[model samples]
Target: MRVKKQKRNRRTVKFFSACFGFREPFKVICDGTFIHHLLAHRLLPADDALAKLLGARVTLFSSRCITAELKSLGQSHSESLEASLQLIPASCDHEKRVNAAACIESIIAEGNGKHFFVATQDIELRRRLREVPSVPVIYGLKNSLLIEQPSTAQREFVKCSEEKRLHASVSEIQILRKEVNETDQGRDSFDPDQSSRTRTLKRSLDSTEKSKFKRKRAKGPNPLSCKKKKSKEVSIPSPNKEGSVPAKKRKRTRKKKDSGLEQGSGS
Candidate 1:
């Protein structure tokens, strides 16, 4: 799908001196070419011209990468490069250095709020810096220093870049949170003591068996049930070696004995 380009509010044409902190010192990031040009053209006092034009003090900054470039530029310019290096009070020394263009761009991008200016005559470098919003460029034009203000499109580009950066950061945070939750679940599910768990299970089983045995022992035979079984056995006939008396004979003997005992008690 083709998306429409949204327009932003057009900022008024305001000079550098009109902005907030316009009077504050602006940092100028220099490259090897700019330094060599400054030395060759005898433009050491160009900083004063820039300050006067922007209505602020100009502080020069460079990186180790630019210094390396100047060194490679050779023995003829070494003295001039040394002199220029003495003038710069600050530098960004990265362990893994890149070209002067990339280093300057990164330093400016990191300085989100601070005012910055790029001093270079490289056409490609100027074009790249122009893509960044609100950054001023200083270059030697017709043997004179000139400054270029950023366009509205550049500012909009910067806004969109920042939004994309913020969205990526939020997604990274969510991914990290999910990873942490999964790690916690793995830790909780782990059983650190296998032997202890097995022992506990055996102990529980033994206790259950003992409880069942005790319940069975507590339920004893009933006395009435035992007496009823003995009476039923005596009423049934028992066979002897010669002959067993019938159940009726046993009952007659028992009756006679009971009657005799009752008569004696009455007398």
Candidate 2:
């Protein structure tokens, strides 16, 4: 298949898997027309062709009603009947044989809880299947097989379900509020004595914690900013013997020779 076609098929498969709970080894229900188309187009071995188109392993299925309807078409559709017989038979719970389209629709029902992918060439059957949520339809286009994109109904259904999940309804909100109020009332009606004891304990614990971590007082002036005090040095005299005299003072005498020299000059 071309890359673009393969990518589109993968995206469709992913959407079904994520939103509709489709898993690996996908289940497919083959109707009479699809089987006939496969034989007519030389696309024999329905399982492999479907597996390749789906990008996963697939188990081909056919209901008893589909096989019976194909048989009723006579030997012209012998090969298609043989191909349909080879597939696993799905239970339609119908005693009487029905049209292939109706049989397939019955199998899919409302939600397609079986997660069956319907492979058919009938345009009307495909249209009907699209209206039902979570049913993926596969159709053959000439030599290539194609999976249809999610239909409007399927997309709208997914959108609505997602909205419901994301936003609670008024009734749901009221139920939640009622639960919360009930829990609150239960708490308020609990033992009052124990509650008072708990409150007092909490207060005492807070006070003790506060006292344990006392706030520091503003510090005194920084020692680095204070002036250093000057130290006084005291001089002590050396001790002398008790009888020893203290140091005496020495006096200088003036000479009379100057006066004598003056008298001699005068004479």
Candidate 3:
């Protein structure tokens, strides 16, 4: 049983601490059995596992199924179990174990390990939760409670995975930006008229080449060319040629007459 003075003293300290902005408390999802065990064994004050590790006390949470189980316990255990239920700061009203697991999984998934813990004695549940990286478990050891620190490798793995994801996202953004810039450049330099003119010029060149090839093929040696005879050129004389004077004789006679006239004049 808690003394009234101690309770009042705690309340006073809490009230003052709240006003002064005290340290944040760790968040712990717990089962009813662990709570009853701590209270019954008078070990709650001495355990201090979370405080030692986190430098702060914890705010407890549980599922409604745990609360119901505590309520249904025999009368012999009712008072202590009831007191334990009251000690929990919040209870998730989901009835199934799966629901509780799901809720705790989400909290762990946040990757804020220093602020969250899971307290339970269920062996199967502990095994399953341990599979999640960086999840700490608090369970009973001997007459006191202890916190099982998360595996170092698990923490490192989670850190590396997060870094890889961030790198991949950043690289993806860079690639997308590069693509967008290239697209913008292409658009800025594009000329529709130039492209169309280029296509027309190419078509004309191709047509000219095709026509040249067809002409060469047609001009190739024909089969009849080998059998054809060559034609000879023949000159024909004119009928009026008998009365025409020769060009050389006319020049000689004109030169002789000029010479005779010069002699007669001289004489």
Give per-residue CA lDDT, model 2, range 1-267, as digits (tens).
499999999999999999999998999998899989888888867788999999999999999999999899999999888888888999897888889888888888868889999999898888888888899999999888999999989999999999999999999999999999999998899998978998999999999999999989999999999999999999655546885656655778876678878999999
**Any residue pairs clashing in model 2, and if so which?**
none
- What does the lDDT read for residue 107 in candidate 2? 84
Which candidate leads the pack in lDDT? 2
- Evaluated at residue 195, the lDDT of candidate 1 is 55
Model 3, position 216, has a per-residue lDDT of 35
In candidate 3, the residue pairs with backbone N, CA or C atoms under 3 Å apart (3 or more residues apart, or in different chains) clash, namely none
Query: How high is the CA lDDT of each candidate model?
Result: 0.66, 0.90, 0.61
Off by over 4 Å in 2: 169-171, 184-267
Best by TM-score, which number?
Answer: 2
| Tens digits of per-residue lDDT for model 1, 1-267 | 111101110121134334323345777777877777776777757577566545567787767777777777799879656855765644465778678887777677743356667788888988877766666677775445656665665667656866886675777989999999998888778787955787899999999988888744466878877855344444556777779664544434443467878899999
- List residue ranges in candidate 3 displaced over 4 A: 1-23, 46-50, 89-115, 170-180, 183-267
**Comparing 2 and 3 on TM-score, the stronger one:** 2
Question: What lDDT does model 2 reach?
Answer: 0.90
lDDT of model 3 at residue 251? 42
